[model samples]
Target: MANPAGEAARPTILRTPLGRVRGSGSAKSGTHHWWMQRVTSIALLPLTIWFIVALATSAGMTHAEAVAWIGHPFNAVLLLALIGLTFHHAAAGLQVVLEDYAKPEWVKITSVLAVKAVCTLLALAAALAVIRLAV
Candidate 1:
């Protein structure tokens, strides 16, 4: 649609409880992250629900039985994938939180990176453990 004469599109500024803020271009990087996070979240949703159901249905089993259930190829693979996706999502969220709150530049940078590293390691360790247990 074209604007009427003498009328121009005004920038949409968001008004929040904290204050009024304007949405600006994410500098490209932010848009990429936002997109990836949403994609991963969509993928994780089903996996999470599956995990819950799998656990619920097998809850009465013994420790060995539980282990065996997870040892199945499909279950093991999905579990590892879920762990990885979960960690990635968590890292992204934590980075945003840190960036929003951390005032000191050095502290913000270090904390965000540190949290990312930890989450990555934890995800890798979990995946490896699942693979080992399954195979």
Candidate 2:
């Protein structure tokens, strides 16, 4: 129907609930980012628990002992995984937030880039520390 301003009416969108959400991700990469976030978070659950328990068990231990604890193969491996996944998840989540909230396009792009870079650097540093101790 024509409006008071003599404008033509726009057609309503016809989409199922799922269809509406099918491509809601940034740059069509929503599914990948969403899945990775879930997987990393799930994986982190056990790793975090183990880390806490390990620390608790090692309470009052000497510096060398703590280093020794991290130096073990299994612990070192899990620690590395935790660091990598944590950073990945953080960068992904922060990018989504910045994309959604940042007003200027440049701000969103720069923020996402900065967040990812910082996360990468921190993860690498943590992994290196773990490797040094393990070695």
lDDT of 1 by residue, 72-113 (tens): 898898998899899999999889899999979999999999
TM per candidate: 0.75, 0.75
lDDT of 1 at 25: 38
Which residue pairs collide in model 1, if any? none
Question: Can you write out model 2's per-residue Cα lDDT over 54-130, one digit (the tens) per residue?
Answer: 88877899899889888999999999998998899899899999999997999889989999999999999999999
In terms of TM-score, how similar is model 1 to the real structure? 0.75
Clash-forming residue pairs, model 2: none
In terms of lDDT, the poorest run of 10 residues in model 1 is 17-26
Which candidate comes out best when scored by lDDT? 2
